[model samples]
Structure formats: C-alpha cells, structure tokens
Target: MTSIAKQIERSYSATRASAKASRLVAYGIQPASRMVDALDTHSVHWRQWQMDVVETPLLEHFPEGQRDALVYLSADSDTTITQLEPGKIYIVGAIVDRNRHKGLCQRIATEHGIPTAKLPIGEHLHMLSRKVLTTNHGDGWR
Candidate 1:
C-alpha cells in the first residue's frame, strides 16, 4: 500500500480490523483474545481470522491462470454488479481517502488487468452523498 495521510491510514486499518472481527462473530466464531488485546494498541487486529493472512501482493498471491477469478469492486467502474458469481474472488479496496484519491482503486485494477465493477447502488436506492461504501457497509451487503 502507498503511504497515505496517517489519520486516514489509521482509520482504514481500524475499519478493516473491525470488519474482520464482525465477520468472525457473524459466522459464530469467537474472535481470539489477541485481537481483542490489540484493540487498545496501535496494532491492527488480524490474528483472530482463521484464514491465512498473506503479506504479499495480489499478483504474487494468485497464479496467472487464476487471475481471471479476480474481480475488483470500484465505484468508478462503468459496469455495475447485479449478482456475484461463484468461484470469483471479489476484491474491495479498503481505501478511505475522503475523495482525495478518486479512481485510484480502478486504476490499480486496470494496471493489474483485473476486471472491475461497481455496486448497483443507484438502481437500488438514492443517496445524498457519493455512492462509495465503507468496508463494513460493503461487507454487510454480502
């Protein structure tokens, strides 16, 4: 991840960690004590997750043959997602730049040759603010 404003970075990290915790609880799994302990510190809460937390880039994590399974979710994408397909790995960039970095996720997806799609928010509900959704909000949609 590129260096962003410290405050935004912290907010993003906290949001992601909280989302992960929420997901674990939602699935009837108790979040580890280590994650709860880290909540009071500056560290992110990633230990409770049962899945492997790979510290590698997406390109390196997935082989070239499996690249087609990656689908990037971006608000700037022309295509809007109607339904998620099985076997596809949907990626939501956990970026909260307050509009300072518009289209950054889409650009990165393009660079990586990953297909992009936006949520069909406009077709479902009208909103006063931009259609961009927070990480937790996006997860709730699932």
Candidate 2:
C-alpha cells in the first residue's frame, strides 16, 4: 500500500535540551500553537509520538508500492500539492523546533525513496515573517 511519510525527525540538541523541553511544553499549552487541540475540533484522527519518528519509521512499518500511495510533504521539496488526493497519506513534518532543521524532512523521505510535495507558498503575498507555515496552518487548509 502507498502511504505518506512525514519525515519529522528532529536531532536532539544536548546543549539546548533543557530549553527544548520547556519549549515543547509551551507549544502544547499555547492554543495558537497547539496542533493536537486544534485538530481535535476537526475530528482528524492522529497520534502524538514522543520519540523521533526516524527510530520507528513509518516506511518500514507499512506496506509499500506506487500503487498504494506513499508521499511526504516538506518545505524543502520542489514538488507541490495544491489539493490533497484520496487514499494518499499526507505526512506533515511535526518538528516544533523553530531552527528550521533545514532539509531534514526531505532527506528522510529521500532515504526511504518516498516522493515529496510542498505547499504552494509562492503565490501568496510576501509576508514579513518566514515563509514556512505552522503545522496548524497547513492542517487547516485541508
């Protein structure tokens, strides 16, 4: 079966480990940034993984094939998906770290031989903030 791979592996930063832990907690409680709570309103079934997804990779877990449909999404990807398709798993990178673990998601997908697509962010007006949208914003589009 084809599935979506969200290459959301965040390399641990030992020097900033304490700060990251606290940052994660802040992300959970803050409604504007809380992804799970927002998704609950839409009834989207999802799970929150405590560990790096790379350890228990989804590509290894699920059956694979082009016929089944396994695609991943990332800002680093060149391909774009304007509309989501049925029977396709849309893996959203779940890294809460703001450092833009740059290309980490795309790298993982490439390692798994999973295709990738990025949101059409260029058509919109140029904003002052960084281009990449929050996970909440991406999920809301669906």
Candidate 3:
C-alpha cells in the first residue's frame, strides 16, 4: 500500500499524465510562497527527461521556453480561489509536513467547481514537478 503522502503524490502524478496526453496544462501549488524564488534558481531536468517543459516558478505568464507543462507553486497563505479559471487542473501540495490546514485548498476548489488534487503531505521538488507535468490544466492562473 502507498503511504498517505505517496498516495497523494501518485494521485497527482496520474492526473498530470492524463493531462499531458490531452494537451492540457497543469500547475502545482507549493505550500508556501517562498518556493517561487527557489524554483527560479532550482534545476529541473527538462532536457534529460525529454519533456516539452519542466517545472517552473510563478511568473506573469507561462514561459514559452517550456511548453506543455507549467508548474505554479503557491504560498501557503494564498487563499484566492477566484484566480482559478474554468477547465483547468491544479495539484496543491503543502511545503510542510503538517496537516493543520490541510484540505482547506481542496475544499475551496470544490466550492468553486474547480477540479483539484490534494497531497496530504509535502512532496520533494522533483516529485512536485512530475505531478505538475502530468496533471490536467484547470481554468485558473497561478
């Protein structure tokens, strides 16, 4: 059986895979806003993986260099569900292992009719990228 965190991770990965084949875009919401800065300088193995695009930090618009996948990591305090667009997919993973505020984001998605996957625990950076590449894109902006 998969661990709770692994289960969440798998669910996200499966979602991303489905989206990639269908030409959909997906974003991974980071647990905290600080990840955004780290992602910009972080190394993503896009070339080695042969993926059209690799994970990325938040930007005004999705980068053209990396097509297909756009990973948007959100800060933990990002409570703006209104930013989501229709027909988009998003995987929200908390940066910390704590579950104190877990499911809050998923609940928000349900309330707005936005489809989302929730990771019970924080996942590694690479795992987060893999999840983003494979999930479907929702109608929302990161």
Candidate 2: TM-score?
Answer: 0.50
Candidate 3 regions with alpha-carbon error over 4 angstroms: 1-36, 44-98, 115-142
Regarding lDDT, does 2 or 3 come out ahead? 2
TM-score, every prediction: 0.63, 0.50, 0.27
lDDT of 3 at 16: 52
Question: Candidate 1, clashing residue pairs?
Answer: none
Q: Model 2 misses residue 14 by how many Å? A: 33
Candidate 3's residue-wise lDDT over 99-134, tens digit each? 564445445444444444323223433444223322
Q: Highest lDDT, which number?
A: 1
lDDT of 1 by residue, 29-104 (tens): 1244332344324335434534344445566676666788888889899999898887777775645535798889
What is the per-residue lDDT of model 2 for residues 41-83, given as tens digits with 9 covering 90 to 100?
4323323533332333365555456425767778778898888
Q: Give the distance in Å from residue 26's predicted Cα in candidate 3 to where it truly belongs.
A: 4.5
Pick the winner on TM-score between candidates 2 and 3: 2
Give the alpha-carbon lDDT of every model.
Answer: 0.59, 0.50, 0.36
